[model samples]
Target: MPSRHPAEVGYGHVVESYVTRTYGGLPRCLVLNGGRFLGLRWWHTTRFTLHLLNDAAAITDEELEALLGYEWRSRLTAAWLIGVDRRERFRARIGALLLASEVCYSGSAYCFALARFGTHADAEILAAYLDHYLPRTDLHYDQPAALGALLRLDAVLGTHHSDRFTEPDGLWDQWVKGVGRLGYPSYIPTEQRRWADVQCEFANDWSRP
Candidate 1:
């Protein structure tokens, strides 16, 4: 059954409908009267989609589960956005994320999000699942994004690799070494990454792209 709360149900429908209409298909753009092509910012997309995921707790378990396994990057992006931005907001819905391990990009989104919100215990949950997925791959895995997310989480939690980060010595160490191999250069700091002044150029690029 759908959620009985009108606000919750309405928000859920709004997001579900939007995803159905536009998630993975052709990008949305338009032409201005000045004859300029305009498109949406990745930040806008991430934020809007995140609004839906922020409401994840209100949706039924079934609806939440359905979203977990969605194939498109948009859906996974939504999940990761929630993981990073609204991790505390959806604390109750995390089990669904963990169960979504089989979905293509879902694991990365889920793992990173959990890392962000998970308590010491929650971190343990993520660490348990660490071995199954690798750091980087051409199509799906993004080491920079994942490690970036984890580092951000660590900062938020105010704890270092004390309890949760430990993995079997050789395997986890090898993955860390592999990540180092990628020469993952740091981008702008987190505050810089999101600010209007620093991001204005990329925002303009999105509008033009």
Candidate 2:
């Protein structure tokens, strides 16, 4: 989708400057600049950029042609690149992707990062992930990247639910154990540990707004 705001394109130039200075090279800056304006196109451009950035070795048999192709990669990278300062601009689409059942496990970290902003939509996604995906015995326990996604999900959910969710003693333990079974890191800060607990309590509510 083209940006409703014309200035958003201009702001893309500003981001180019920032990314250029931050990366200490002009080539990466240009790529990032394309990414920002690509937000105007939004889905396709972002997906292509991410595919180029993350991997170029060879296409995979498991890749989803309709949804999981280059476009999805761009959206994922857009989520990956969005800093705390620029989150509001991409929040809606990112939130939509997270709640969709079609969202890939490989893109989980992007969703987890979005949750750090703690929007209600993000909270909803975390609740859904906890309730639906985390409990299956055949859960993709061997994927370490999935664990990063879970940790970020846990971190954000923990921040929100730490107070009320902690009333029960064993609630958090079951969660930690579940994630730990997958070989994820065990130590979440007391302040940032509640998502693990709440994921244990989620009841498969995937309803999104």
Candidate 3:
């Protein structure tokens, strides 16, 4: 809300600088009792989460608009703000981002944002994402999350948009079943855990003498 904030910001800095400038107590992460860093994501820390929530509350349309569709961190933060506030104006942008799937982990956030908007349009967006990405068994993207969001929205809006995808041995079924067949994907680009991938990764880690 302050005019003192810069008109533009760069990768990683956009959300961080905005929150730090607008609110003073933002931490890069929250150190838990186990000595693991909570990391600056989602609502993990009360102080920092409050900072993000407050920042989202005060972010002007201009700031919000600037934050979306840029760096992953900024984009994720922007999606969170839009979803939390139910900013329906940015629904299309979120849907576009979901379809683009360019931001990797950003899909879940986008899906959640659409669900928050809670309209048939939102369900349509989720369905559209599934329709586009569900077939690529070779690529395990956010199909599960997107479909889950669609089902959630369907429940709320009384729409059966998810039925076609969820039918027996359909695309969704193939995806779930085929993942294990990809026993060792040459690349785990998204770092999303796949069928039996945890042990493989763990074996790699353990084998490292």
Score each candidate by Cα lDDT. 0.40, 0.38, 0.60
Tens digit per residue, CA lDDT, model 3, 1-209: 22222344433445555523422333331121111212344344345445545655677767776677455555666776676566899988888778887756656667667766779998898888888887887877777667767766666778899889878778777776677587733222123223113212222232111
Question: Per-residue alpha-carbon lDDT of model 2 for 1-209, expressed as tens digits?
Answer: 22222123332232222222332233433444333323334434444344433332222212212122233333343443442222445555554555553434324434434544545555555555445544453443212322333454546456443323233543344555676787866534343434322322221221111
lDDT of 1 at 106: 46
- TM-score rank, highest first? 3, 1, 2
- Lowest summed-lDDT stretch of 10 residues in model 2? 200-209
Candidate 3 matches the true fold with a TM-score of 0.69
Q: Tell me the TM-score of each prediction against the true structure.
A: 0.45, 0.38, 0.69
The number of the candidate with the highest lDDT is: 3
Model 2: residues with Cα > 4 Å off, grouped in runs: 1-75, 83-89, 99-108, 140-172, 179-209
Superposed Cα deviation of residue 106, candidate 2 (Å): 4.9
Each candidate: RMSD: 9.9, 14.2, 11.1
Instruction: Give the better candidate number (1 or 3) by TM-score.
Output: 3
